[model samples]
Target: MPSSKPAFFFSSTQSVDNRLGDVFSFIWGSYAGLRELWWQVRGFNTQFPDLHISEIENKFLAGLPMPGGIDFKKLFVKTDWAEHEKDFSRWILFDVCTLYEGWAEKVCKDLFSSSTYERNAKAIQFPSGVRANRQVSGYPVAVNEANTSASTLMKDEFLPTLKKSYLNCWSFIDQHLLAYRFFKECRNSFIHSEGVVTQDIIDKHTELATIQAVKPSPFRNNFILPSQTLGQSIELNLKDCINFATIVRKLICTFDAALSVAMASEAILEQRIRNLVSNNPKWNNLPSDPAKREQRVHRMLAASRIPEPQNFANMMAWMQSKGII
Candidate 1:
């Protein structure tokens, strides 16, 4: 007699649970680090008023050439503190973008892997000559590493396919994908150009330039070249970085909630299937062949016409109506 339990069920559920914890933990830790950096910047400003006053007065009165020959007298005088704030902002923006991209990749991989497991466990056949035909030993390589962009993942993968009930949980993050992209571009500019404000960088980020306070005003003043306009550079300030960090935190919360919903839904379905099999003596004495037993269970579940529940409440109601509770 076969057990009739799906072999992949337990492992798949556990994998999702563990990965969700890891993702949230990483996001929270990153947010904490960003806060610490913010405080450190404030501390530096408070402790070093003399540096700003002395440097600004000397550079102005002595007519010393400031960096890039930008006149200190015309610009706001706190050049040293402003430079520190700009550099810190760039650092935070780059790292936060990296964290976000990494999380997106991880979640996508987890979902695809789970879907693949379910299909294989049910022995669901795929069309011939399709990408599914590239399976290695009965498992398709569904982990998409090539196109990990947030827009692509949300539009093409996450939003459309996630259970309807979980969509609302992800809505806020989905709506802010453009903001994420802007940060990504900033990270790229810093890494590739060594923070140079080139015409190409300006053109690439023009859409985000209209955004007031994208960079800290004082920091922005320091970077504005005589030949360059305000929107022509890739400079950012500490305040801008802090605001972006808050956005990232919100995204993390939304994603965490969605994953929780998904996990609960999976658990409910698993329990329903188990109860169905356990309550039937026929299922208990399934065919000796494991493949045939699995097919029997799959057929029975499909015939029940009980669609997969989207959340715990839906699952409870369905189970109650079917006298499964």
Candidate 2:
């Protein structure tokens, strides 16, 4: 019941390792694009004559030719140029508008729709597929659909499961969300406008300084620094987003582990009671007094080797009766 399966940190470690590569590329690519864009956007009138389109694009392009053949699909999922800046012309501003508000909406949608992420996709269900009739095209269509699907996924699958896990890890959730929101706001400001992003802004908006003030966790909390900020110009990069995405995936896995363990523990308890009922045959009508039943369970658990919590017996019984175990 305590999970014979190994800790998810193995998967987490591998995921983080792969994610770091994406994040690193994203950061470098984003910064290159941001630097180029800044000169064009802010220096358009003054430097337009000197700016070369190919040079600017090439500077940030990272020499990774437009993905083709077998690598296209994988590359798209790992990092998208449209979402990143090189494909600005292809980006649907309206769809970007939705993600600028919240990461959960987009992240959840990707989880559900991507066949490649089958484990996550299977978690979401379509309720009658009523919206299936709608037909749309273009980047806007895809983005809008993704948003809708993500919202449904969050409501039907993520929210209920996450809430249950959150009960066990509320403090972590709160701090993470705070940091996420800060990143979102700061990211939007720099990406959307020519405004300068300063270290202070990143610190205050990201709450990195505030978080640093608090005691650190056993795990290294790698502080995220915005790549776009300069003394006078803001540079946009994709690394931060990828890193944040990596963090979200880790959180989901962590929650899944906890949920599985909790379910397994209850299952073990339920089986124990059922075995008792079948073996003794008199367990069904043994006692009607709730107080006495609780006391019996308390004493039995106390005598056992495992140090269970006070309400564990009641929880186990409830799960058994509901067949949830």
Candidate 3:
């Protein structure tokens, strides 16, 4: 007896030009919608008892007469339905964490794809005319593909090579990873075991409980109810989900800025090289043969020590001093 109507209703039209921005907007919209829905449900229940239609409907539905001096009122009001609230919070938190992980994977792919860094790999040659061949891949493919946890991805793939300026950003993400893992476990338990709290789950929660303070400063604030026993379960509230969404937005912004900087720097370096080849009389006067032209450019670039353009500004300055630009 399945109903044709959907259990939930949501609609959005994302901008095609900015996928990452669209993701952030979607996350923000979802959080706001959840909050609005929660308040609406709370207010509806609060007003239900005052409405005469509710009592009439109840009597008609139950097929019972309204007895003398009987108070026909709902037992629960003010959003105090504990089980429903708990389930709602858990669902929201789980969705936010899952989306955050997907966003991180996209960032990894955008930053470390083969097309982005394959040419940057250093080539090594041996005396016997042998060269080493190493395959380049995106961060997700190059790192542990089996591990899908965002926390693990940060630790294994990003933290090791992140710049000092970006350490604060990494810390912001790290602070939430434990809570995200715990939420993931809770989601699994609910899905597989009807929300039964097992000993193993409790132990795992206990192990992850004390990595950091429950409150993530002013930036992100998520709660993990301390569970010390087998029967107890972790709890995430609406505020926790909202805070997590905020942190995720911050991570996306910071990572996008860093990637943009790297890309601009790369573009600047390439432009400098092109300018050098085009403007320098020596390189410009070289034979029009493609191979010879390439060889001359290579020799000129090598002599100017510009093989790997690490610092774009410094490289440009050096090239100008060497009359290569």
In model 1, which residue pairs have backbone atoms overlapping below 3 Å?
none
Model 2 bad stretches (over 4 Å) = 1-169, 194-203, 217-219, 224-232, 235-243, 253-325
lDDT string for model 3 (28-140, tens) is 57656645655554466456656664654453336656455332233223334565456556756666556555554444444344563332111100001123555433222
Q: How much is 33 displaced in model 3, in angstroms?
A: 8.6
Of candidate 3, the 10-residue stretch with the lowest lDDT total is 7-16
Single out the weakest 10-residue window by summed lDDT for candidate 1: 138-147
Task: Mark the regions of model 3 whose C-alpha exceeds 4 Å error after superposition.
Answer: 1-84, 109-167, 171-175, 213-234, 247-325
* TM-scores for every candidate against the unseen true structure: 0.38, 0.31, 0.41
lDDT of each: 0.44, 0.40, 0.44
In Å, residue 300's CA in model 3 sits off its true spot by: 29
User: Residues 183-207, candidate 2, lDDT per residue (tens digit)?
Assistant: 5445455576444666655555546
TM-score of 3: 0.41
**Cα deviation of 217, candidate 3, in Å:** 7.5
